[model samples]
Target chain A: MKLLQLAVAVLLVAVLGGSPLSAGARTWQIDPAHTNFYFTVDHIYSKVRGHFNTYSGAINFDPQRLGESSFSFKIATDSIDTNLAKRDKHLQSADFFDAGSFPEMTFASTKVVDAGQGRYDVHGTFTVKGVAYDLVLPLTFAGVKEHPAMKGKEVAGFNGTLVLDRLAYKIGDGKLYKLGVVGKDVEVLVTIEALADK
Target chain B: MKRTLLQIFFLGIGALVVAGGCALPFLYPTQTLWYKTGWEKAVLQTGHLFGVFAFLALVLQLLFGSRGALLERAFGVSLVMRLHRANGQILPLLVLCHMALVLLPEGLANLPLGLTFWPEMVGGAALLAIVVQVVAAQVRQRFSLDYRRWRSGHRWLGYTVLLLAAVHVLFVADSFASGLPRLALLLLVGMMALRLVYRMVSSRR
Candidate 1:
């Protein structure tokens, strides 16, 4: 009787660990209208700030089941906007993102670590210009509540920042970076507002 | 004394124009933001400054070439012609420096090209025009070129360079993309066009 009970318990644990939904994590789709993805980089004497205008993601999250939570995003590389059309074109050219050959940059979480007090460190693989690099984005849960405008809907917000080396991803000409025409470190600011799927 | 005063007044106006043109790039909002290291910033700004000075020199070359009655009276014809020759000789050197400095930061590999870089290509054409005009002027006697033909070609080529440089400046960067800088550039270029037209008509008459 003891052996049978132990086997049943082990099977139950494996099933719950393998399936995210069974573990109580809910699926949430990113609300594009309410989310923002911004980035900044040094350009000669002033910083250039820009954002990706088109992106979509899904989040499987549960405060009680942190281990089962995950996040995945797909951003259209050609949607980069820097206010200056010439610069934007340059960035999208072979010199930078090479958005022509690589139309999308993606991130999928491998792990998420809770740091207490509504903070989390998300480790993921970030791909840009067909180059992939491991990245850790530090995020803060900004709380969840009923949607103000949408009836019978819940919205959750997550904000995070990640510093990436442009050279690692080969985002720009390495020679330019060495000459300090553009700095290597790029700061990406992410604010995601997601809606729970019923 | 009257001639001296007029000379001084015109000289003052010339100095003011150069100063104002040089200041326009720095007045750009992006100028104040810290995006690059001190040395890189210095190199980039110096490159822009060189381009600005070159443009001013080109404009002044036109003014001196005009040999207008007012300029001749304010400064003798000999002095004006001498200034014109000296300015022309230095123009090529200024342009080379501007090109080198601007390319240093981004490197030669990233030298802008293609249809997307039309403004920069226009600037490149202007540089080529300068080279052609200078070389032709220097070799005219060797080639036994006709004086009238050479002068006419030189005049039209100078006008072309002026127009090309103006378009490059107006569209090349965000600094002059809008607002005060755009207005100032249009006014300056328009004034030059008017002056050139007036000179052409007056000469024909």
Candidate 2:
């Protein structure tokens, strides 16, 4: 029992970390060419897949920093593609996304928790079309490596997926709110490739 | 009785077919016959099929049941009522299927499947309105309220579907987009307007 207790204490201490990471310790710039934001919808009997074609964002990485690391991004709502032109327009109209009134969908991270093994669960507020909601993203790190495209530059990756219930933010709200015609629970798949500045 | 039954039988089979998946080409005004395009025609055909069933069920509900009798009749009343209920439930699914065929593809087709075409959003607000009413009806039913109140909701959704479809045929369609289909589409709207006027005048009396 004494041996087990000591082992548990050591594990807890190691897991807890020596100290919380300070703010602005390490800032990472996003590479637009590498990042992607994809979403899915239920199209009646079938499922429709789409994504935002244009977006830009930056991330501040501080592993132990809960409130220190900041992330922000803006995606052009009009650049959304389900591959269909007319439906995309309808999605932007009043009955659906109302992208005309509220164009850019944005997200800014508030806090991130290190879950060991270079994994993190980021809590961020995401504004889609116009509605805002708190989002939790469970992320897996792809590790830092020498970027093949850029000489002497290192890039870090984090891939995460989250189910977004459109009704929460009222993206396509109201009764027809039915996954009936539209879809319920849009999948938000994000791939962030950030570069270390120094 | 048999003629009505025959019409209903055909309508039922067609509705189930289009509603369930096999979208057969059937056009209104009875003139164009089965002229169809790749998929839009499939959707129109399905919606038309559902409309046929809706019309049949409306007629059955109109002529068959004793709305006020309460508990008088048996056997046949229960049977017809059952059919009416079945038809009622299936009706919206068919409409939804039809709506998806036309609407979903406009956005989804761009993917690798090419199942949807990014076409035109010709319906001003009709489709949107229908979505609202349908949801309200479901809520009302779930809440165990009077189905009669749903009539108003039902009527509005129907009107929206018909109106928007007319506009859809006019501004958006490619082949039947203009000329005679336009005229016939207008005629359907006119008929709907007249029905509304008649109902309003009679209700006021």
Candidate 3:
């Protein structure tokens, strides 16, 4: 009985002490050159798509303990590109992202829930035009592997989709709001490729 | 009688123009998702609206000289001519404003005034057509050209502007990809084509 009790106590101590330290979360920096953050919005009857040209982010991930992982991203509002120079300038102005006043739109994840099959529900605070909102971005892990170009380095890729309401951000208020010409919903698609630090 | 009709007609069109301009933004609230700022979208959209209005006015002037003149019976040829002159003078200013507002927002250096890509090429060609027409109209009298010859040249230039403008709008207009805007554009172009055909048949007769 004494031997059995000692074994049980040892197992309990090992389980409790090992679980937290075994998280093994690894940090990776976003490879901006390979990352794409694009969005689509309803315009009249069709959806118009565009991309942000500049962004940076970091991910702290643990495949085994996925719930403890975290992510943070920052995008330069002025880097908006829709293949139109004039349109981009207008977007950077006070009416849209207000790139002058709020140069960067950021997202920092608070909770992550692994939903099997390499999928995760990442809840974060997304700030744009100085307005912060709780947003849930559904992310899928593409994979992690040895990079061909970067010697002795590993890369991890993730894709996420989020739908946002423009009106919620007060993006097009006043007459434009009443006009209803611009669609209220904006869909964001994020492709992140990160390089693991040695 | 002619003066009263002319005044009333002008007053009615004036009201329509003012109301249309003010109500336009409210009617089409869905701006392109590509734009970051609402004001930017509004400015770009306003530029497009001005171009569309100018095109309509120019088309009306084109139809005025036809056999089945819509305004001649009601407003008299003199009043129609006056309206045509007004449109001719005002159109260049409208075109100037449209081009400036449309291109200047992108920054002067980045203006897509090139012949490489189709959209930019078509827009560039349209601007060129407008410039040619304006220059020709301004200098035609000084060149001592015969009235018939000058009128023929003027008609051809007008046709060029219409064709290029149509191409530019079809290619670049944001809401043109579907539904109402496309349908309206098709109807307007079709009517214009039918009038051109009728004018040709009558001239031959």
Candidate 4:
């Protein structure tokens, strides 16, 4: 019985220390070049897609310190593009971005919550068109890797998706005029390739 | 009596312009997709609402013209009249968007003045002349000046706009088909021929 107890204790120590869940903090810098901010809106009864050409942000993560992780990101309102010149101008007008009044769009992370396996729930305050709203984005812990250029740095990457009812956020007037020219529901997909900060 | 033809011409041509604006389709896979086709930039800012108001304007203008003419052709002439004027004034403004994208500085640099601005100026002049003629015919009927001069100038200016605009779109639109320009060129020639024949027949009578 003594021998069995000793073995059990040893196993427990090994599991606690060496497990992937072990606590170690990491901070990541978003690779702005590789990052993409993509969104889609309703187009003439069908779906049309678009994205911002300019956006920058960072994410910090540590599996052990799930509650401590945070992120901050911002996209330039002027960077919006819809691939059609006529439609793009209209989107930027007071009818949409009203970019002149609200020059920048931003996102600042508040806290992280423990979600299921290797997953997390990140809460952030997002400001768009000068309106601030809190959002809970479901995130997948993609794992950490040593920074290619920095010897002591490690980066944590993640893929996250959030559904935004632009209506709730007051993106555009939800009232459909002349048979729904704009769509209310918007899904934002973010793929972050963040570089670790030493 | 002559104003009837003018209204019909404006309505017909206005519908063509409006329909053309609506039918414009887009193709992509470009890096500067926004700059190249930046409709959202305009729509979000001012063009969207402008589009609504302009369409409203077209209907209004159409209704005003229809007051003394036939009302049996359309339903709710009041509403449609609002749309007619809204569309008429707004279509050209909306064209500014496509112009901003497709007619980038480089595109503008290459087009001849005739294809670029002169033809439009001629068209503008012709339109102004038509307005003057309409006023003169209504207000100065005692002068009894012949109408053919103004009509001739207006017709020539319209032809100039048609020709130059065709050349302009062919050179710049990038979407021009293999034979469409040639077909349009032929149609222009055929229309000119038919109109001259009609003029000759009318003069003989």
Candidate 5:
């Protein structure tokens, strides 16, 4: 009877301890003021650079419990700015992102693999224009420090680059892309700074 | 010898116009997409060149028909009339080529329509006006149309074509959308308008 009770106790402790809620994962809110999501693509012989003006995300991170760490982000598609209003309108039109139908793009991490040091390989599903694609983002955690202005609050920084296939996402007219009106691969550079929830 | 020198000078001006129009696309190229293949680049460039040529040809048609003192003295009234007729025939062909080449890479299925493509629609209107002007002129004698009435209609249609063409060129492409190219186009159109106005006022007098 005692042996059975001891087994039950051990199982309960193991189950509770392994739960993500109890894994010491810290929830961090993305700081829109400091975060940047810039993208670059080849436009003929030149490179066109643009960025999303509105995006928000959260990071659930615990260095000790890497398996429980995850990241999620949502970006407003209409907030894309390429410094040219005409191009931006085209990007938001049916020929491109179709922002009227798909107003937001989202990303959710499925797995996170530590690569030693401050680097991590985050495998996630990125949904754009109503299509989801598996993507792996190699990110560097730039350590954490107390907010200089906001005393007692902690801030963490992360940055990574992601290459997206525009055709796969149906972001633009395939025929135009084939004729080289726009590039196939779009490189996205992400820089995120988050404040740990109190 | 003086007449020959004047002819050479006019020919040099025509060459400069053609060269300048062709060079605008390259010099003020919009950083949109680097064409993937040589064939596409050539086709697209040729399409733009044709558009420029068509506009210039329309302007030349006006110049030939103007019966200006310099043109009358250099080429005689009969020769100027022949040049005007020949340019009218070629103008429609150049416009046709421009439409075909520009639409080739973009595909006919993706041809932009409605108010959103206002500049392209203006170009279409200009093309329609050119065709009507040319066809009417061709059939004028067969239809027993009075020369005075036909000439008045032709002059008005010419003005309309020039207005539409100027608007299309200014708004249709990125090259002439702004900067020095836009300023130059405005200056050329301004000169053409002044000449037309002068002709109208002088004829009335």
Candidate 6:
């Protein structure tokens, strides 16, 4: 009877561990209307700015256990808008995003480390045009609040910036690589406002 | 007195072209004002101004190329020819400045393969034509080529360069999108066409 009771206790522990309710953090879906992903690059003389219009992401977080939080995001590559119709078309071509073959860019965080003062270093794998690279995004949590429009719903806000090398990702090749008409480093700024699931 | 008037006329046109190119940023607010450095803006602006001046020099060369009486009345044949020769040497340098100002900022590693677009192809052809004209002039005596043959080749190449230049200017619509500058370009092109046609008809006679 003692051995049977011990086995039952072990089985109960395993069941509880595998349950989603036991997870430390809540899942929050990024609100598209409130989230913006902007990128800027030097265009020989001045900085050219553009933003991605379509993207979605989910953040799993618990402020008390920051290390256990993770984020996964996917961006539709073709939704890039830069004000100029012709230039936007060129950016979508193989010379830049190559949106046909690689319609989406993605990031999935493997680890999140607290860096004091509400800052975090999110280590993730960023995949672009089928090329995946390890990148660390320095993020800051602004605050969490009750949704103003939806009662009983919680919302969280975070912002971060990431710098990427175009050549490192093979975004530009051949003439573009040698011309360097566009700057090598591209700066990406992300502002995320996510809504917690009820 | 007529020669002085002709000089003033040409200088005025040259000033107009350069001023138009310079004023492009103001007429169209499309260009971004936020630059990392003032040098970048200066390079791009100077490059465009130099491009217009270079093209104007080319047009002057074409206009004064022949020793026709009508042109001689406005500016003596000898004076016209002298100005043409002077521009021939100076035009290449202006082109070099324009290219350097625009391209150097991009760095050396970004040399794409070869001419990929229509404007680029025409611009490349114009540059090549100028180089060939200079090289052929230098080597004609060495190669023992007939003077008439060399002159004919030179004239044909100059015309080709002029034609290619027109296409290059028109295709580059960033600064000349729509305004007085664009109107001026079209007027200049129309005047060039009339002059060329008149020259051809008179030469045939």
Which candidate achieves the best lDDT against the true structure?
Answer: 5
State the lDDT of candidate 1 residue by residue for B159-194, as single tens digits: 899999989887775678889878877887798799
lDDT tens digits, residue span B93-183, model 3: 7777777766554545444544424665676676677677667767876787687887887777777777777777666665555666667
DockQ of 3: 0.04
DockQ score of each predicted structure, in the order shown? 0.05, 0.04, 0.04, 0.01, 0.05, 0.05
Per-model chain A TM: 0.85, 0.80, 0.82, 0.77, 0.85, 0.85
Interface RMSD of 3: 6.6
Ranking by lDDT: 5, 1, 6, 3, 2, 4
Q: For candidate 4, lDDT tens digit of each residue in B1-205?
A: 5556655776786587455434333221112233322344333223323332333232333234333234324334574556544444444554444344333422333222342344334433433433443355444346766667754653454344334444433433333444543454345445554655665587699
- How much does each candidate deviate from the true structure in C-alpha RMSD? 9.6, 17.3, 11.6, 15.8, 9.1, 11.3
lDDT of 4: 0.56
Q: What is the two-chain DockQ of model 6?
A: 0.05
**Per-residue lDDT of A87-129 in model 2, one digit per residue for the tens?**
5665665545666577788888888888788778888898876
Q: Interface RMSD, candidate 1?
A: 6.4
- lDDT digits (tens) for residues A108-144 of candidate 6: 9999988889988889999999989998988898888
Off by over 4 Å in 2: A1-23, A64-67, A177-179, B1-205
CA lDDT, every model vs. true structure: 0.82, 0.61, 0.73, 0.56, 0.83, 0.75
Q: Candidate 4 lDDT, tens digit per residue, A1-198?
A: 999999999999899876646645456778877677778766557888888888877666777776767878888876677785445544655556766578688988898887888778888898887778888877787877787776887766777877778777666565442335566777787877777545
Clashes of each: 3, 9, 15, 49, 2, 6
lDDT of 3 by residue, A27-60 (tens): 8888888898999987667777899988888799
Model 2 lDDT on a 0 to 1 scale? 0.61
- What level of docking quality does candidate 6 show? incorrect
The regions of model 1 sitting more than 4 angstroms off are A1-85, A88-198, B29-34
Once fitted onto the true fold, the runs of candidate 5 whose alpha carbons sit more than 4 angstroms away are A1-163, A167-198, B30-36
Q: How far does residue A49 in candidate 2 sit from its true spot (Å)? A: 0.4
True contacts kept of 2: 0.07
| TM-score, candidate number 4 | 0.49
